[model samples]
Target: MNESKPLVEGAHFPLALSRPDLIPAARYSDPDFFALERDHLWTRTWQMACRLEEIPRVGDWVEYECLGRSVLVARVGEEELRGYHNACRHRGTQLGVGRGHSPNGFTCPFHGWCWNLDGSNRAVFAPEVFDPALLEPEALRLAEVRVETWGGCAWINFDDRAPPLRASLEPFATYHDALGVDRMHAESWFETIVPANWKLVAEAFMEGYHAEQTHPQLLARSAKSGYSAGTDPLGFVDPEDIVGSSLYFMRTLSEGMGGGMVHARDIEVAEELVRMDLPDDPVEALSEWTTRLNDEIRSRASAEGADMPDLNALLSSGHIHSVNFCFPHFWYLPVYGNAASYRIRPISPEETRFEVWTTTLWPAGDQASTPREPTRRPHDDPNWGEVLRQDFANLPRLQRGVRSPGFDAMRLARGVEGTIANFHQALDGFLAEREHADLLPALHGVSGPIDAPIRDLGL
Candidate 1:
């Protein structure tokens, strides 16, 4: 956080890349692609590690799981952050567990191989047992990993000459910076052991085409009020209309949901009731009629003899999730205009963990105060939690479907398929370059070293 120092870069570099959209059907279940990604892709990239609040003091540290490797990030000094292999510098034993402060630097319980927060080798137990010259600081500091911070988050990379974070994030930096999100303390996070590859889960959120059938609660109650998602240039929009279009309907929920949501007019009354409760006039403030709209979708589905999924309970329970997939795994779902942050990390090809936190920025005065025990969600509230039991419950089953011998491929929507295509392309690019080393020199448009930005921090 010291402004005067040279901005830091991660410790690694890119080894390869793939064309974003043209992944083979076999990659999903192929053990070969899985192994390559674990080694070349995940290991080399600078990844979002942990939120700033997770470690707020000197010697603070947290363990992160990436691919199959376990790593640790530590706050060793007032402004300097360090990363280690999470293994003892001595006999390669695992270091600290969970998250907490380590004021005395890191001392391995096994054989007392100690590390300074700055990652220098401070001491070794039983000095007489080892040669004095070899154990000195120059020779024995714990191996350092690369680290950086943006938007109050710290990221780390394991490569020694890794590309700069800013460069890799260049295309999306403006949007990333515009997110006025600080770290949020998650109230609850739901984890489902999906049977599908990590890519499948990412694809599910990348596009909204599946909402009509997969998310009746979201589509029926909130789709009309501009049910939309911001897309990267990679977004796939189906050109064909009515028969099958891929555009996500720009949407938001009317700031309320309840039994009254069964009808559209009642939702309007509820919004009025909410507006009256607030001190400011709701007419001028940014607002929408999401909660005020409803289609007789359930009855229509029934009349058309559609075998409704068991999601009637969730739709009737009046819960709506305004989730934004912040490209890759950052699912930004805020609630009631409060603060929340969600990130999913891949543990392996088929398993990923979700980290959800609810936090609101207190803009330093009475105006920034957030309501405690929030009970409702606005479509635009980025701080809301994605209980997501309804969303993630079927993933494992879907994963299993991909594994079925009879199923080789599934269709994607045209208008809404952009993210899905982009994700596949990104994944393919990552996997392709990793496997084919010769392609590196030919990567014309995107390959460049980005230096850490040197900016005035107003010292």
Candidate 2:
């Protein structure tokens, strides 16, 4: 539990913060609030810049852009990474556009000012053309941005005073580490521009309450046996049938998402599970099946020399949350040694860039190949899979609906939508510029996986 504290006692503009269950509707559509986030929230929080695999070799770099600012993250050595403001010191020219290699370090195209991968001043186009004092080492070195690596991704923070990445992540890091998340790498990556605020788009995936409504196919397929037999009001006519239904659920979930949630190998394990004899009672059978499924998945992956975790132990300890929300703008849903992830960034008050990646564990002792640049597509592109397409359909509608004159605020469900509330509360702490000591507790309360009711956020 977190200590309750009033972090936004005097906040006047956003009326929603006064109530725990309500979110200001204008926060999604108002330019003023968005600017506040640009100046306060984005500048201080740790955010995923790029997957480590994207820059496998030295001199490789990826430019991460958010709220009009750009950061260039580079691989300076086999185990070293560095980030710099993506602007040249001379005339403020932008340094890099996208991901690429610059073996000779970054050279400003405008005037040929150069900085090494370590951010030291390498050369200036014409030393005699400027004041010698201006060409000093401190003046010419690239402005540094804080860079840290975790979960196989490079994260950047603009504020030098911000806490270390791991310290800020807390139980979120502990949970992911238990699941072997750092060993997983991107198998596929894609991106699309969404017609909504970044927060609205991210909130869409923060809970399972919408599963039955928004993703009816998933619910229907997974629950077919529960309501299949008309004669059995309780849907327990045949206990043995539960095995078949469970198999179908896994199969359909994997197929519907186009291999986003469960990997092909997981489906194979499910197929194998149905061949075994099981208990006659449905509850007992399900219990046995779940235990075996988790164990077998880990065993099979480990047999192939892939780094795998003790899934049964993790499940018993309640370490698996299905969907983990890294505060502000990142999420990863890991299942059976495979996972799907999301990274969201604001493009404007009403537009956002959303990216998705499917990740899986690689064989131990072998480095995973570099993931190709994400393929950008329209928000409604079929290639995003049926589940995501269905989720995307609601984003534009929600964005437009929030602006209605009659709509007062977004009333969040106390239990199911707790993560959404947690997000806003943490954002308020930043926007209010609370002291680090005062804000750290609230950050810890909101920095882990979701699927549970709201906890005391110390705010």
Candidate 3:
């Protein structure tokens, strides 16, 4: 790994230091920094290209585009998938545009060059039209991109020398596996373009510190005692009526976020918990209520053959996170048996393409029919649930504010904002082109959910 360089004055996008708490302002708005990420981070990191369900059958394919490159991921055999650069070897024409089923194989629209499902050259349009050297079998084969599957998605890495996806994703993979994340599938998908740097947009969802102010509807207020400074912002339930307060909390959270954090069935389980006889002490009652609620939710889902994981076990093991961040550009909030996931991509220094998916477990074969394409909308559209609309309102303004001359670096909360800090630190390693062995430990530190003070990542 490169030694920590002293922060030089007037440097363009200087690399971050060993401390994972502060971030330079220029990293978010500078074109040169974005170019560095395009060349190093995006190309080397393992990124989710598409869900495995999207290409379940042989010959099924989807085109994934990033920066200016397009890759086609296709199922070639009953249990095998392959990825290839989307361009044809002949004339450099794109062979696929979007999701498709090519039972016969891909044929170039510009010319008559064709490639089989396994990325082997099938046939040339005419033998006499090209030089013999150009038609050599090895030269005509499609170029392959590295691909692997995990958590039900196909992840691709442009760098052939990059470590295997599982090895790079350490403790994060272990946690998600404990939660049965591989059994989950998208229930709804949506996309929008936000006028904000990709990191700015992603950082907005990395912490819960903004929830009390930005999403007032999600706040709990006492029914009898009314609002008071002593009231906990995290929970507003009145001690006198534990049942009513618990019900209100669950319903508001489920509705305000549009059913991703808490599913409809989870609400039903909470209602049943409220009716049972319990202790008179409000604190004890709340504790018992929470434990039973979690247990019942899992048992019911399992009884219905939903392949649900042991929520109580995961919680006791500390594997469950309200928000888990996979370094580079992915985050997911898992609650009950449902989860809400976010992915962001840079379009420019001030613009990003963001996507959200509401995911949950279903019967074995039921997820095959879920929609593969996200419904595109403008960032300001109100139809994005109450919680998200409130969150989106601040993105563009934050992007503009970061560029002010008087503003300097971001001051992140040591405890709540550790994910954001860890992200930038790991990014700096990539921009510096550090050795893979040195980078893996830092990547593991940045991989899991964040809710505590900054950790010594061994940078």
**Which of the numbered candidates is closest to the native, going by highest lDDT?**
2
- After the best TM-score superposition of candidate 2, give how far the Cα of residue 227 lies from its true spot, in angstroms: 3.4
- Count residue pairs with overlapping backbones in model 1: 47
Q: Write the per-residue lDDT of candidate 1 for residues 247-366, one digit (tens) a residue.
A: 112122322221111223223333333322221322222122222222223333335453322223433553233444433455554433233455666666677665444543212233
> Judged by lDDT against the true structure, how good is candidate 2?
0.81
What's the distance in Å from true for residue 371, model 3? Answer: 1.2
Give the poorly placed runs of model 1, Cα more than 4 Å off.
1-23, 183-192, 220-328, 334-340, 362-387, 434-459
Question: In model 2, where do residues sit more than 4 Å from their true spots?
Answer: 1-7, 14-16, 220-225, 228-239, 362-370
Winner of 1 and 2 under TM-score: 2
Cα distance off (Å), candidate 2, residue 115:
1.1
RMSD of 2: 3.8
The collision pairs in model 3 are none
Candidates, ranked, TM-score: 2, 3, 1
RMSD for each of the candidates = 14.7, 3.8, 3.3
lDDT of 3 by residue, 106-208 (tens): 9998868888888889989887977898888888889999989887788888999889998887777877777677889777788999999998998887787
Tell me how far the alpha carbon of residue 454 in candidate 2 is from the true structure, in angstroms, after superposition.
Answer: 3.0
Give candidate 3 misplaced runs (Cα > 4 Å). 1-19, 220-222, 225-240, 364-369
lDDT of 2 at 87: 90
